[model samples]
Target chain A: MTRLTRHDARRILDGRDRSGRLGALLDAAAASARPAELGGEDDVLTAFRAAPRHAVRPSRRFLARFVVVKAVIAVALLGGVALAASSSLTPGGEGSPGQPVAEGGRADPAPNTPTEPVETPTAPTPSPSDTSIKPFKGEDGEDPPEPGRPSGKRLKQLCRLFLDDPRGARAEKDYPGLEERAGSLERVRRFCERLLGEGGDDGDGKGEDPQDTNPSPKPSASHEDTSGPGGPHNGPQGHKGLSARSDGTYVG
Target chain B: MRPPPPETDTELSACVDAARSGDEDAFRALFRAVQPRLLRYLRVLVGADAEDVASETWLQIARDLRGFKGDFDGFRGWAATIGRHRALDHVRHQRRRPAAPVPDEDLTDLEAPSDTAAMAVDALSTDAALTLIASLPQDQAEAVLLRVVMGLDARSAGKVLGKRPGAVRTAAHRGLRRLAARLGPDADARPTDPMIPAGALTPRDAT
Candidate 1:
């Protein structure tokens, strides 16, 4: 017997079989419809009538799912953008102040001095300083004032008085303690000026006239001192000013 | 040995379109044309439960006919695909609740009903032929039934079976060769003999 090729099978399946025997066999095998098979025509027709005329089309279902999926994706993208924007903004705000504080804290040999400068700049009113003065005075009076290094309490007091009434404080009688802490009254005024600059506290605008006249040289000197290698004496005030300027630039 | 004339593609497509528009007679016409082939294919797949699965298949077809597209050939393939799915579902359902196994004798009797007195001989031969085809491997039996009984081409049969056209063709070829071998040489010896006459061999004349 010849082998049945795919082509012969295809021809026979398509009902164009040249060989009569295989075709006849297929015809006989395709049995006539029994009563049971045709009996369900009425039932199927009843189901057809019961089914909705137009419940839902497949394309319509697909389109609805597509829209819902797209909406979810769009909302997720917007949420991600909002979260990224807020996160990016917070780091910049924190890094501006934090970098200078970190640099100052890292470079300063005296960890205790850095906190004093941070507190002095934030105390814009005399009343807050007066409240803070009592604790310091009690703490410092126990340790007798050192000759070359004035106590922090005494320095803060002298700086406030000098800022309030510069002429009166400069007179040798009003703040004899400050003049005695230093060698002369001239040195006391210069010390107060350095303290105020380090504090960055020109907020009251009371005694800013003298400093404003020569402020350009001070900032340039401070900028040079800060930019140069390892000038820890002037670093705190320079760092504070530098951080405020950077914060302004970032916000704008 | 001749089968009845099958519906032409034009008439079948017309019936499908009209049935989609809720024409009852057209739907009945489509049911008459497709039900026998569907039942035959399902009998091979699910045995005695072919009628139940075919009913479920038609219900789904009736409900989803509005969503169907393509011509009459596509409609047949679509119906076959639905029938196959329902048959598989019935098999799975049976496996889940396997209370008692029906005997082979009862299954053969159920397939060839004795009540059809006029067509008893034809039904017996048809049942024997189907039983013989079903005894082959599952893929070969499906390939033969879909290709021959359902009158689907290899590609259409491939779509219904979820196989590639080449694989379907090869399977159908191997199945036909196996069936030919099983039928023996005497059945094939007179293929070109003039005893049957050439006019009777034509597909149109078979009707």
Candidate 2:
């Protein structure tokens, strides 16, 4: 029971008839990996042809889901249109009548009273002062100001707002129609002005210049080893005989 | 009628392009051409599970055949690399699952029975030497296979194994030494045969 010498290790490691072993191994591998029961050359060819086609075709599951989604949307749209059409055809159902209705099936008001007065004033035209609040224009028409300014107490409130609960921001309505809040819109507008900047100045600490284009590591007095430690030359430059090249390249 | 000589890489590339466009026959020819090499590589990578790995490798190649971008040689190497990886994975799996025990037969040391008669009458066969080689470890086996089967030099073998050329040369040297040891002290004294037959275990009858 002697330990194998380097020579023995080498001899064993370098032995020749590797191809036969490789062949044997290949046979063993082929036995297990290939789809053997699938049949012979014709079967293989068929499978090969079928496989690529199957891969290119959309998966049945995906196609099925796509059809179901499209059908559901189409049904919903058709149902909406049918309801709309039925409502339009039925009288006294929001659609305007051709003539004015009478209590006893007779025209009541005088025609001179004006069937449709030209200056009846249906709704007042909004004044410029009423529409004073304009949308905050963004830089390059992108990443618009997030609305509202945040100063001292409001800034502190904002800090608490985010720190207390970040999800609260989503609940705040930026538009007029739904879920009105008490003075929250103004607060948000002011907060956004401070956060996004009074004029889209980017009030966030990053400010106007986002990326730091210039970077400077601390200067060190240590000299570089040009000769590469073990190589010839005395100075840190390590240049043995030749000085700097004419093109300003360091010659070692 | 003799069909035109075996398709070259350029021809194969053109065939693969057609195959990608659903040209069934062209794809089949490409598969037949590369399957053998892929199988061989996988076998080396995974000893007994070559079939499973080779099948899986081919199926994968078939699935991704349309996406193949390289020339024939590149395609071959890429496929081999994939097969090698799959084979390695199978080997790892087998190691995890303890299977049947390997026979304690030391084929490495099996000495070819003395054949003084062959030297006297028939020529020495290369298979005798190769059989002696098969008894070596996987590394030596691969080195020999690459050299003899692929006709690669020691440097090329090193490139395949990602090792230094000197290391491959040393491995080859050691492999020959083991062969000599198996042949007995007088093995070197026996005339060495150079010619080899394809596929068969026996070398060409002594030159």
Candidate 3:
């Protein structure tokens, strides 16, 4: 049936007071629902006075909570300062008042000793160990390189960079042609290796370096895989996995 | 001036006048006379937690009772305004509470027997219906209940709900639509005439 129109609504409401079923019901309800204890306004007042102060003086409780929070913050600040100062005073901090001599290590001077300030040569940095081992060749039957592991600060810096600008880290390879964008060869090489070494054949893998666009070989596919980073449909093309909004565009 | 006792309408007005003149008993009597209806109104407008709200409403009335200068109806309207505010406060409080399953057994008893029976005669007495009505977005439900059940006209209901008369009518319409939907097909069979038709002489029709 078509929903009750407003006129019908008005009718139902009006008919409730008649002697018919609905009307009788309404009458009974109205009669029975006479709110009692209506004269006990003083009792309600007495209860109001007896009830919790927190309900009555909310601002006071709020102030108390604020004071407690401030006191805790003050204690925490004092404790942190004390801990930091004590730790800095402990034995193994930076270089002592006087101690050692190594190229990249600390220099030392003893008490009462007139030491000549020597100009230490800022040495040429040692080159990183070659990581030229190719990601396992398909025919060799070796597993794809485990990209999850990396050495020293490289891993930390990579993690920090990825965490900070995840999008840029993924698209690092697409950047070389852009004028202001520059990346170190080692960093680029590492990014490329990480991209290529991930085992999944899907081109949609995230945390991938945009420079290496090669489609990995599927375990089920025996055909020779030809798609690589510089291939026509490969590099910096068709990245996926970002969220799409209602407007039919990818969101951050 | 000595405060008048607020047992009757004249007493209530005199009590208010005396309280205005700094008579504490007059103020206390005024509070006693109005507190019950205000509490019941709050309890219905809000929920069971209206005890606290009722308390707060009275405290406000005690503080502001002298400010009201009118006949008994005006005093009632003033107290009603305070009660409505307390009810709103309770509503806001309920919203802030985390959602949890309302146990079926928890709803075993409700205080509105007469109301339930009234609804039952029309076969509209389901607990769910009451809850659904109560749970409707506040503006709509308040307008509908104040106007329909309490017999307040749109203008008076609007004043109690702090909305314009047009807004109150709209809210009541929307609220009834929602309530009809909740009622399912049964609401179709109900009579279709205004409960209180315009220009009705009898108090029953008037309400």
Q: lDDT winner among the candidates?
A: 1
Highest DockQ model number: 1
Instruction: Mark the regions of model 2 whose C-alpha exceeds 4 Å error after superposition.
Output: A1-44, A52-252, B1-5, B99-134, B143-207
Instruction: List, residue by residue over A25-54, the lDDT tens digit for candidate 3.
Output: 233222222222343455545533433231
Residues B1-207, candidate 2, lDDT per residue (tens digit)? Answer: 111226876787677667655687876666666664454443334433445566655554554454444445434533553454344434432332335321223221122343466432221232233343444554554555444433334554554443455776666666555544443333222233332223323222112
lDDT of 1 by residue, B1-207 (tens): 354636677888788777766777777888888888888787777666677778877876776565454456666766787676556534433333345343343454454345756566666556556655664556777788887888777767775665666888888888888776665443544443212223222221121
Question: For residues A1-252, what per-residue lDDT tens digits would candidate 2 score against the true structure?
Answer: 233344544433333222233222222222221222122345446546755363342343345445545544544544454466456765443332323332122223223223222111111222323221111000001111233543445454443343223224322222211101112221222334344454454333322221111112111111111111221122222111111110111000
Descending-lDDT candidate ranking: 1, 3, 2
- Recovered native contacts, candidate 1: 0.28
Tell me how far candidate 2 lies from the true structure as C-alpha RMSD in angstroms: 27.7
lDDT of each: 0.54, 0.37, 0.38
| Deviation in Å, model 3, residue B59 alpha carbon | 2.1
For each candidate in turn, the interface RMSD (Å) is 35.2, 25.6, 26.4
Model 3 captures what fraction of native contacts?
Answer: 0.05
TM-score of chain B of each: 0.84, 0.55, 0.53
* Alpha carbon deviation, residue A247, candidate 3 (Å): 32
